[model samples]
Target: MTSTLVVIGHGMVGHRLADRLRELDTAHRWRVCVLGEEPEPAYDRVRLSAYLRNRSRAALSLVRPDFLADPRITVRSASPAVSVDRRARTVHTAGGEPITYDALVLATGSRPFVPPVPGRHLGNCFVQRTVEDIDALSAAARPGRPAVVIGGGLLGLEAAQGLQLLGMRPHLVESAPHLMPAQLDGEAARVLQDGAARLGLHLHCGTTVVSVDGGAGGLVRSVTLGDGSVVEADLVVFAAGIRPRDDLPVTPALPLAERGGYLTDAFCRTADDRIWAVGECAAVLGRCHGLVAPGYRMADSVACGLTGHHADPLDEMDDSTELKLLGVHVATFGSTSGDAGTAVEVTFQEGASRYAKVFLHRASGALLGGILAGETGSRADLAPWVGRRPTADLESVLFPAPPFRPLSP
Candidate 1:
């Protein structure tokens, strides 16, 4: 009895699952069908901002050229699964096609969150998410105009920098006291703020957007801040945040996260054993990992389960991330706490562009975690030692090694 699997998304995580299944299902035990609402196949959304500069759709593609050639796999673009008839084990698409599957995987990914402010639907307001979004923004981007990017997160910063690259003045707004509130400590955020300023992005932190008002022709002309201050702008881009795309039909009405996303077990399995969720849509242990690395790990776990391997349930995934935002390098990993004085903390802040800090067990000197804001010179090496036993040679890990005047060895 050949089992058919209907994957209801084709984003990075969905595609990864399909690739793994194709690789492992040597006996062809399962035939696969992937549904993507987008007109094009899965592409690298991580680099979506680069679309403005590159303008080549082919370059952002994550789909293999031969993906469609596989005899056991089929892909349907521009088709979204509208509803799931669980009793019948079928998925109904917007195109009026019913796809039957012995098992279903929901990887609908996420959607950009647009805050409900007056005139949000104004002409020049956009959300930075899909390739089409960047394309549309790029079309409206003109030299010497100003673009207001709402949010100071990674995506928001990316949009700001992309607009700056296109010769447009970019202003960044954030409700948080600093950028990347979830990832960076106060000092680290200060460092990142300095970097953004260097890249020509005007900062508006710790304020809210009151409203966006339109001028003649109903295009975005100015924006009102929380403090009643207004700024002239040609366009507004919302990179606020993302919410899981969990509205799609799921048979049995799978449990959803309080914040919005499909709730699942560590194995990525929903309430029904035959159904699974992964990627941004899967909320494991009451939290959704918006990053791609954890999504990949979940994809691998689901693949192992479907391939008949008793893979251990995903637990304690390393959420450490390192990336360059607007040409600023920022990285953080493990526990960030050292204020309790339980651990020894060493910090080095060089001017406004560089800050590095590492925490170690006070007694044994074991590496705990660290923060690298501006210029991180090979500090990534310390990530692997996060859980390792303490080493006596903490001098090497310090920003500046202690003076070595010993016998010229």
Candidate 2:
């Protein structure tokens, strides 16, 4: 009997998993069914903001237009998995088709988080997650419409930049005290905020939206803050955050975290062994990794385990991360803890656009985490050492002079 593998989200992680499975067991006659809720093949969601700004749809295509030529993989666009009958080992689609599978993977990724505020239902309120959303927002937007993006994280900042390109004066509202609170420290957040302001983004920190008044004709007229202050705007985009969509297939009894995510063991398997979840939906151990790299690692581990190989469940995704955000280079990693007194940090600032910070555990001298701003060259090469949990030469590895210059140079 041929084995059937049904992958629910046809996104980047899903596509990669399907391709990897075919590579591992080609002779076994495995049938791969990829279902995407979107009406198109998987596209690079990471570049959605760039698509909005550059007005280029071709840049985000993950699979070729004629990807269906692959004999082993069959795709269903605009179809979603409605429910899964664990006992029958079959999935029911929204269109009332039953897909029986020996193995089921829920790559049903996360969705853009929109907060509950008055007038949020207004017509001009938008989000930039899918191509359709970008098209709608692009059609409704004009230069100098006074747009406000709620959230100061990576996505929010990126959307703000896109709004500026559309000729709108954008302001960012962050509930946290600093920007990119999950990725950057207070000092680094300040640097990022400065960079954003230079790109014509206004910042409103430590503020929450109380209500949005669409008193104007079907458009967001102004947003009232918790402090009774209001800012007038013609449009509002909620880039607040992402939430995993687990409300499908009749809401399984799978354990969910307090912060809203499906709980899974180290191997990315839920309580039901036949159904394995990956990507943004599964919370490995006790934490849900929001980034793509850790998600991909989880996909690989599950894939390997099913093929009867020894692959450890994902653990400790090297707290360090470095990236170029809207032209400004930023990095952070490890335990950047100072109040616990378990780590020591040192910062070096040469001039206006150069800064580096290194954090090390006090007793073990192990590099916990660090950051490089304004310079991000060769930062990825250090990821392996950080992922392996070895005691690094903090001073030498981060601040190598001349011939052994560190990544930031």
Q: State the number of backbone clashes in model 1.
A: 1
Expressed as tens digits, the lDDT of each residue in 1-409 for candidate 1 is: 6899999999999999999888888778989999998999889899876777779999999888677899888999999889998888899999898998898999999999999999899998999888888888888988898889999888898888889978999998999989988778778888888777777789999999999999999999989999778888999999998999888866568789888788888888888878999999989866788989888888888888898876787766667778888778888876667654767777766667667677777776677887777765445667667867544554354334443221111
After best superposition, candidate 1 residue 226: deviation in angstroms?
Answer: 0.9
Model 2 CA deviation exceeding 4 Å by range: 64-67, 250-252, 337-341, 376-378, 381-409
Candidate 1, TM-score vs. the true structure? 0.93
lDDT of each: 0.83, 0.76
Residue-by-residue lDDT tens digits, candidate 2, 1-409: 6788899998878877776776676465578899889998888887787787667767787776444787778999999888888778888988999999888888988998999888889978998888899898888888877989998888898788878878888888999998888777676676677677677678899989998788656778888887778998888999999998776754446677677667788888878887778888877776777777777787788777766667875766544567776567887665555544776666655443545676656676565666766643335544445424443454344434422333331
Counting clashing residue pairs in each candidate, in order, gives: 1, 4
Clashing pairs in 2: 83-249, 143-167, 144-167, 320-333
Give the range where candidate 1 is weakest over 10 consecutive residues by summed lDDT: 400-409
* All models, RMSD in angstroms: 3.6, 3.6
Whose lDDT is greatest here?
1
